[model samples]
Target chain A: MLYLSTISWLQEGPFALYRWNSLKEDLPLFFHAFLYTIGISLGALALAFVLGIFFGILSATKNKGAVFLSRIYVEFFQNTPLLIQIFFIYYGLPLINIVLPVYLIGILCVGIYHGAYIAEVVRSGIGSVPRGQSEAAASQGFSYWETMFYVVLPQAWRMMLPPLTNQLVNLIKNTSTIAIISGADIMFTANSWSSMNLNYVPAFAFAGILYFILCFPLAKWARHMEEKNKKAYSR
Target chain B: MIQMEGVNKYFGDHHVLKNISLTIEEGEKVVIIGPSGSGKSTLIRCINGLETITDGLITIQDIDVTKKEAPIRNIREKVAMVFQNFNLYAHKTILENLTLAPIKVKGIKKAEAEKTGMEYLERVGLADKAAAYPAQLSGGQQQRVAIARALNMHPEVILFDEPTSALDPEMIQEVLDVMIDLSKINITMIVVTHEMGFARTVADKVIFMDDGAIVETGTPEHFFTSTENQRAKDFLSKIIHH
Candidate 1:
């Protein structure tokens, strides 16, 4: 009887954290932020894919200089924290008179950060293909680029799809970093709305649910692709 | 014709091919036999510029293979190779695999390449399997498609690097049958294999290698019945008995 009364007090008293009336009033704002998050994620994902493929091919090539350049790009982006990258783009660049719009900064930093990981995924995908596939292409007089386009990339694409989809899921989650810069994404809206009303529990819980809505299907699809790839060559 | 003069290859500190000189005439059928890692495959691979020779001069139809600036693709255009593992493009249908090189490298019309591809598939008796993926076929069927792929290129020479070595015992005969039929055509053939019977029946010249060196070069009769080299004799006995 005592524990039940305490629970009710926490739920409805002055110390209450999740007020249904307040949350209902802010639902439209949260919905708008959700849309903004989707826009940022889609833009960032496109940029990441472009950079990933370019750097991945550079790393996979036999040329020493190209591989070296790609390694530098991947290492620098992968080693540093995404927060620092975001802060640098948002705050540090202003001192140097290179101010970017908040949305642009969010897309650029998250896109470039995830681009390094996607490049690795792409490189390993290409590496997973047998050496004989390229050699056989060479024996038939296909040039290096021709072999990649016609034979190697088509095969590597199959192996890459699952990991690439997973990367996209990660990309969507990482867009939350836009909140720290006060970009009007879902996390930003949740942080601001919760601070005003001290409703942190319901605020964060709903934010989590929104993110899950975006990512769960992608993660599930990746698992399906991985399973199918395992059976690809089997009778 | 293909020519090699004092070819030597090294993998880091290990010597793979010693000072070797050989000549292959046009339309000649030459079979190379040796123990594994004896540089027989390396020798043929060097001819088509697949493996770089450390120090040597190799020429195919007057194209210098040793020169970096030379048109190696031109040489590859003239010479096709069938690998031990078949190495078919796994993502492509068998017919697409056959037509890819001819259309891409030779700049043959897609229609004409498809026509040639179907003809070669028919030659290898795999016309029915043309729509199948490499993974969907048996080891022997894939090798036949690989052979048909080489034939689609209309190459002046075909290099067979242990084409039947990776097949099941029951399937070896199918791949060999295609190669024997191939030898009847007027194209230069350089094969590296352990199939002594195929060598005896089809090879115009047989070269034996041991320890990165050409131990003997002779006709099949001389190699099979009258070779005086102790190493060749020993190798023959072990292979024949096995």
Candidate 2:
């Protein structure tokens, strides 16, 4: 048992509002770590979007073989845990003598992990487009790919924006998982700060605020885009 | 010209089209009128290879449509379709809808395609709406743009599938006027519609179908006033008012 002081918890020594001043000197480091978080998320999101769109289109195709191939990829990634996927890349790859830096591993793991869900979003988005659109395009002598690119995908993209933005938000949060591997992202910095200063509550609270800052505008933009599309298409 | 020789189509054992043998000569306007589920639309769809035939053959402009190796895009260049819903590309402007195929498929220069597109837009009385999207236009205006989009391809045959059925009653005349003008241009057309007045005026021949088979084939006057088939007479009595 430890001896108790007479002071209240909230009003006590270093855990109060004055503790934030101690963090003022380390603000630059935290900001840089925040940049690393954003950079990693963007890099992962870009890779995920490309892979997702490709797999999504593949799954939407009428070809049995192509759809089967896409199904395998989607199911495999989506079913596995993100943490295991990170470790597999970070730790398992070296068993075969292929080593990658932690940042690259984080990007690859986060990208493919979220790419599976994005593919599902894309598949359903493309599916949601009216069949008549493709028929009309084909009737106009547009080839399969031409119809997809020029007509179908544009409409699908509009339908897909909301869900895709949700995925981006999730990707941003998921970046914190990289902390387990000691990746130098914002969450990693929060972990280090909380441990050294024993300021777990404030450090995590600030980190959560930073994540909110990153994701809030994206969610707002998705809603705005959805409203714009609804108005544009409203009869 | 379009020809279907004993064509049959099935949607998983529900025969949508049965032994559809028909010929539409170049410059001839053929109107197909029928009750719902009678396969009039499917017959026209077969000519364009939009619905694959289960058996027999369909030929449009002397190209076999039943061959799996057939160049469908090439076939479609000569055959264009106007849908009941006026399936205009919603993301594109009316001008872009008209110009896209001409530029992309026909390999016409963009400027030339735009000129051709605008000319057809003028023909449909929608030149003023070229900058507008399909959603911005009324149902009648959209149908007119659909017609212009088909015309931009310079297709030998245009298939109209209930082009006026989806329009408001007051809006029907505007689309019919465009169709009437198109008929006067001597381009071959196969129209599936409930508008008997249009058929009586513009059709070179009229075909009546029931239960996936042709019930009667005659001049519009014959089908409208003197058909011997009981089903055709019943259908006419049910649908025709004036």
Candidate 3:
């Protein structure tokens, strides 16, 4: 039934946008939005990683206060909805004289939201290293920070990479959330352009393809890393 | 060089070490033998501040181990430990593992530390495996590398915590051989092991523990044959007969 309906819609509906000449005209606008999406994703990714690593190390430390502070950051950002965060930064912040640019708002909201998830990935990565590793380092007179820098982090980095790449993929896909704020990202372009020309199917389908192009390779690489990590300790 | 006075340790409600008091003289090779879960590992672990005592005092060369403000790092620099699993940094090559602590903790020059590291690796008969990662080596080879890593620290005291228990039967002798060679030096050695042969050959003093207390302390002959403590006798019989 679904297939028959789709075929009938293709034959009888306003599907003129699928024509090559019309698509060719819309390609440049889509490409620009694609680049914009990439830009916001990269900026947000940088912010996320910085916050992630900082909070990751903070949570992993032995200090109770440090761990507690990171716990609060992780919990607050993780439990709340990302769309709500984006709305508050983009719409509500301006009410209190804190008018951030749309681009900055997109970066901060998305970055901080995913930063919580990345922080968890990092904490678990560091935790996965054998306790004996740190004990050995301590017995050799290594300071806590020195042990982390020299022994623990190097081992943990291998464990962290696959998960961290996964977080990067999530961060990229989440850049679409910026569309609601009129950030001119790929999703926004698809919405606005398709509405104007009544070409929702092609525009939305191509927008998905663009996101797949950005995200699929990263997700695939993360799976590859996870596979390699399984055999990392074996001869 | 190490003294424990009424050291007590508890894991929540369960007591793990009780009224432990002993002294390890400089350059003396002391071997601790006991059944599993007898707190022998915990005792030596306390000497280096790895497991904090619940009550009482432990001092290494006049440095108080139980004091919160004590110089634990300084004590660790002088006291090295060899673990049963030979916890070499799996990410680093053998040579890198050997040189890491000296260069980082002692602030030694890289070249000088590498030279000393190579010498210790050669001493442990693993100079050829310097470029190898820990996972690339057999259990015996890895433990030998661990010993080499510890010796590179030039510690005044070395603690061996069941160092050969993790190796295959064919591999235990190789690691024990490295440790036997280590005993000839003038550094204080505290060993916890089930190997009666190693204790007989290398130990100047032997101690037996059970139920979180030192049950017997004596020369190897006294510990192996003449131990009057019933718990030590039972432990000896079980391990020796098998």
Per-model DockQ against the true two-chain complex = 0.52, 0.51, 0.52
Error of 1 at B217 (Å): 2.6
Considering every candidate listed, which one attains the maximal DockQ?
A: 1
The 0-to-1 C-alpha lDDT of every candidate, in the order given, reads 0.92, 0.90, 0.90
Residue lDDT tens for model 2, B62-131 = 7898999998988899889999999999899999999988899999999999999999999988899888
Candidate topping lDDT: 1
DockQ-superior candidate, 2 or 3: 3
User: Candidate 2 chain B — worst ten consecutive residues by lDDT sum?
Assistant: B233-242
Models ranked on TM-score: 1, 2, 3
Candidate 3 residue-pair clash tally: 0
Candidate 3, position A128, lDDT: 91
Model 1 TM-score, all chains together:
0.90
Clashing pairs in 2: none
Residue range A1-235, candidate 3, lDDT tens digits: 7656766666645664254346578799999999999999998999998898789989999899999999999999999999999998787888999998888899999899999999998889889999999999999988787888788877898888987888888898898998998999999999998788777777888899999999998888888887887777544
The better-scoring model by DockQ among 1 and 2 is 1
Better of 1 and 3 by DockQ: 1
RMSD of each: 3.0, 3.3, 3.7
What TM-score against the true fold does each predicted structure earn? 0.90, 0.89, 0.88
Instruction: List TM-scores of chain B, every candidate.
Output: 0.99, 0.98, 0.99
Candidate 1 global CA lDDT score: 0.92
